[model samples]
Target: MTNHWAHPTAIIDEGASIGEGTKVWHFSHISPKTIIGEQCSLGQNVYVASNVTIGNSVKIQNNVSVYEGVILEDFVFCGPSMVFTNVRTPRSAFPRNTSEDYRPTVVKRGASIGANATVVCGVTIGEWAFVAAGAVVNRDVPAYSLVAGVPAKGMGWVCECGSTLTFRDQKSVCHDCDREYERNQDIVRKTKDV
Candidate 1:
């Protein structure tokens, strides 16, 4: 028997790769050749395409569809109803027939996308970034950045521990985790003892 758990109602197509301790809830469908790493959670009604790659310890909430050309790294969180689009300009009359036309999207490690957010393809969401609910991201997000609003804008920065950062003199420190950061123009990087 496979080590992972799948609901009796879930449909896991043959050749789909599910890692140990992963769980697929009711009414979900995992397509063949999709690789889901260990300890991930696939909620109800989720649809995973064969070309997608999901890393370890990921949590996907209910009603999420992980389409082709999307890669989610370890510890990423996909909130309920959030989506990743494969085509930037889609039309029913001009359907994209080949994978080459699909723009790939990468959600880096430890990022959290809120419910109802839409990540446009060809963009990279950096590590530990947070996308608030209802935001539409069209560009690359820097690490620890907090992006919101339609056509998402970087409004603030967040700590890896999930706290809003307060900057002083272009430097911010996470009170919760005691992590320090230095801001340069629009980018922020963690300070290391060098």
Candidate 2:
């Protein structure tokens, strides 16, 4: 018996490893050699390329395509229509189709990517970081930071519970969840979790 659930229209290829309790919704296609963790949700029309690794409890919304070389850690949220690219440059005359030509993009644990956001290849989106809608991310995003706009820039800091954090003396306490964080220059880390 199958532990996970896939819609009748969804296609899970052989050699794809999907954990128990995960759900693949309508018209979604999971390619071979992809590993999707437990309790994850793949929404409608989602396409997962080969060799991609998605951690537990990840939520991938509709119309998102997870290309090769993309690594989504546990609890990551991929908003609807969010884009992930593996190639740096493309031309009709020249094709870079192999895995060696693809650049790796890592979305750390608890990160949330907003709708219509485009994450370019070779970037690391940090843990608990929030990418606002329509942002074009080309660089590494720091942990617990909020980024927005085209070629996304750091707008503010956020708590692990997804609340905006107000830093005073490089430290802040989350008003919503009461989580505590400290910042050293550009780096932010959770000091207390309540």
The residue ranges of model 2 lying beyond 4 angstroms of the native Cα positions read none
Q: Distance from true position, residue 182, model 2, in Å?
A: 0.5
Ten residues in a row with the worst lDDT in model 2? 90-99
Counting clashing residue pairs in each candidate, in order, gives 0, 0
Best by TM-score: 2
lDDT at 70, model 1: 95
Q: Write the per-residue lDDT of candidate 2 for residues 1-194, one digit (tens) a residue.
A: 67999999999999999999999999999999999999999999999999999999999999999999999999999999999999999777999999999999999999999999999999999999999999999999999999999889999999988889999999999999888999998999889988
Candidate 1 TM-score to native:
0.95
Write model 1 residue lDDT over 1-194, tens digit each, in one string: 79899999999999999999999999999999899999999999999998899999999999999999999999999999998899989999999958898899999999999999999999999999999999999999999899999999998999888899989999988888889999988788889422
Q: What is the C-alpha lDDT of each candidate?
A: 0.94, 0.97
Q: RMSD in angstroms, all models?
A: 1.8, 0.5
Q: Candidate 2 has which clashing residue pairs, if any?
A: none
Cα miss at 122, model 2 (Å)? 0.4
Clashing pairs in 1: none
